[model samples]
Target: MSLHPFSQRPRYSQWFTAKPQTVVVQPTTWCNLDCTYCYLPFRRLKHEMSAEVSDALAESVAAFADGAHPIDIVWHGGEPLALGPRKFTALLTPFEELRRVGRVHHYVQTNATLITEAWCELLTRHEFRVGVSIDGPAALNSQRVDLRGRPAFDRIVRGIDRLRVHDIPFSVIAVVGTDGIDHPEELLDFMAGLGCRSVGFNMEEAEGINTDRQQPTPEQAETFWRRTLEWSRCHAGELEVRELEYLGEYLRMIRAGQRVDWDRRRLDPIPTVSWNGDVVLLSPELADTTDVGYGNFLAGSVLDRPLTDILGGAHRLRYVQEFLAGLEGCRAGCEFFDFCRGAQAANRYFENGSLATTETNYCRVTRQALVTALSTVAAKEKEETV
Candidate 1:
């Protein structure tokens, strides 16, 4: 008999190797703010995760890490800070243990309203990367107020100052409403003055209970972004302005000779598991049934199904495919598609009805803005050269 049937197979097999990166976890669906364009409207209440659910989530995260994949756990709304220091510690203990064995890295995305000294201590102790949501200054942040209609700018600035005082590393996330569109330079300058090492700009998306469609037009958006990018190129200092919408265009302009190996759609994946054992398909926008594309795409409860199976299931793949197709559609037809990642899932759904079929307002704004700005830059450069 042959030593063994097909026994001499190669030692290395693609199937046996591991794929890095995993899920982004949402610890709760609750939030402190009632921003006009929030995607998680239903998350206004205080919903805490039971120890049982936390334990199950920890196990699931570890399973992914055990497979040679480095797991990343992103703590998000409503406001994870609402969990309080003691409860939050309880929630993170299991993951912290896993981190010692090189299983996971933790990150927190917060509004900075509830950030306290204790919270900062926990974050620094765990070396968690913090991303705080603050629009621009008082004027720009007015729309990001709490349910009581009080502006959160002062509170947010205080939280930021606390972080800086304690030497905790953090980044800022600003939402560009119509007002900010007209004053992009002022907004950019405001954030730059905050001493943030990195800043992310988000265009307002109409979602949740507040259905006000008050975003800048495509032409206006284009102008705003172009101005912001020009400012960045000249006076960014040590700060890195991370404009997700214009990342592709910047990369193309600066690294034209190099092949860009990035997929903006894949920045955050679907089946985002929540604290209440629910799994949402896309961002918080698609989580509420009132939102345009809201459907019961909840794969399985964290307490019920294996995370690996849920992540690999047909439903999850379909959701991602839908988003990828939308992105491709923009890439093929739109002039500024390269700069904006089509549009966000929520924006597409609320504005269009389907994430896959929608033409994003952000896309319109980005393309128009980028092309106009680049043309202006080229003209200026030509004049200088002459």
Candidate 2:
């Protein structure tokens, strides 16, 4: 029996048998809308996940997570709602058996363009937490148009309005690109108007199929966040920004004396099953993207074997080994490693050209900038109030 290397230390091991906390299932590789910055490599492949593959996951997860926290299944995609009613229900049916032994929490992250009353009823019936990807207002969403280059802003908003009308609780996720970086107030006001309690801001990350997008400069980001944080403090009780949420968790961990090192052991801590039965660990974004140097990162196929057998086989993969090395290096060298746990591995590979490299435009703009902005605002506010 081999000890899980990531247990109680930050070293690499030849094998690990730990259970993942979440399972990200991509039901299809086909997306209706083609955003300018979409990173899905197989969006045109137009494949969908089968029912048998879904069962393989539910069975394997129930086997290991019987007494653990609620097993989370994040329905991701090219676009999960693209599966529609029949296919979506078909996909979730296998997990029904697992509810007998333990709780299984399901979540769906969608583009909000395909949302309708029927979709809302299905989500309400199952009580699945919903996350809608809408980048603020219509102007900001123009970049996320259909494949034919027609703007999808009106349709996306209409879908969100439908979700609201259905009384279904959901959160919003917006990507902050170069054009949207300086207009944080517009983004903030738009979401606040929608009555969203929490929002996730994903920068136009240089990763996968979208490496050409420019990473925001520190000055541009700092200016945006400082103003945003000030606005957030005014609306503190009404809304919780993503970075502020992370900051709150970090502060709580400090008070409770818990370590803030979100290590590689827990990075994704979830398996992402691609439309075809191929499994990828660490990051869901890495599900279909591959590099020639690392070869195919398909850890294993559920159609051929159970997840338990496939997870153990990750120890032999070169990408996993190199990524672990990068994680170890980030912990040792980077000052922000404690807070971010080396940042996302896919971003490092796309920007720095290797997983073993430390720091990237992503870590700087996303994690480091937020930390600095929040802390700075707190210090300034303290002096004035005192």
Candidate 3:
């Protein structure tokens, strides 16, 4: 995995984190419900991971798992639970020994429509952290529908209720598009009432197959974050918003005059393994996307090569090289570089059509807008104190 002399510069030497903190595994791609804004390319297809794939993944995980830092094995997909409890449990069996030694932790990002008492028992017994994808109340969640185009909200809530009954704590991931952004207070109230551990907002973007997305304007984005921050402050400590939490930490670091160590600020590889065992490094959103230049975004297959070896050679990929160059551009240009480090690879590719570029509507709305909102609020608060 050698690079040109220019790429061998000190700054580019450690561009990517060799040991990733998280690995997303696609157990299956058979999603029951059809969400309107899904970006997955093969969501309609049914593909289950073979036992050999899991065994190979376990071997890769074992090689990376040191006792000090526990790697998060996130089971993500077209809907991981679509595989059902029994089959899913078999998949979990491979990592059981690694988990017992506290070298790995399991997490599942699911739609929650398939959750049952059996699923709850499996999740609890395995201590798997659950993340549910629900936009808002029934109206806002209308986009999540069954194959018959019927709203799946009732079923989703039913599944969540089962989780509650079993005392399983879970976080909520709400997709906020033009519809839900304006009603921040209402959205906050709805999420807080769910008794979720935390809330994360995912702004809709034109990614993968979901092109022609209607994105919010810059003003609307800023206002939405401003209002959301205001609402969060009013109900302080009642709900933990992921963006606001990160904002707070960033502000504190800035105030303390802490500069980013560019060398140490390497991007996490975040290897996303497809059901067939193909590994896509960096963003999980890059798993199935393809380009003429980058091919199918695959670094290598875990079944054929060790995960560590695949990651080691990741920097040599054409897209990864371009992404590194883009990061350098971002570091040199954007004022928000310290906050975001560098914006996401998927956003740059999907929205801007190239990974070798910087600035996109996705980053402007999600990253810059939040920073502007919080900085304004903090400055005004400081004035009042004086």
- Candidate 2: which pairs clash? none
lDDT of each: 0.68, 0.78, 0.87
Q: Which of the predicted structures, 1 or 3, would earn the higher TM-score when compared with the native?
A: 3
lDDT of 1 by residue, 115-233 (tens): 88898899988878888898888887887888787787888889899999999878888888776878977887887788887888777766655467678787777677677767877
Task: Give the best candidate by lDDT.
Answer: 3
Candidate 2 deviant stretches above 4 angstroms? 1-17, 100-102, 260-265, 382-386
> Candidate 1 regions off by >4 Å?
1-22, 66-69, 244-257, 260-268, 290-295, 315-332, 335-343
Looking at candidate 3, the ten consecutive residues that score lowest on lDDT are: 1-10
Q: Which ten residues in a row have the lowest lDDT in candidate 1?
A: 8-17
In candidate 2 the C-alpha lDDT for residue 313 amounts to: 64
Steric clash pairs (candidate 1): 29-78, 30-78, 30-79, 31-78, 222-369
Q: Could you tell which candidate, 2 or 3, scores higher by lDDT?
A: 3
Order by lDDT, highest first: 3, 2, 1
lDDT of 3 by residue, 8-101 (tens): 4443456666689999999998898899998987888999998889989999999989789889999999899999888888888899999989
Alpha carbon lDDT at 3, candidate 1 = 25
Model 3, residue 152: distance off in Å is 1.1
RMSD in Å for candidate 3, one decimal?
2.0
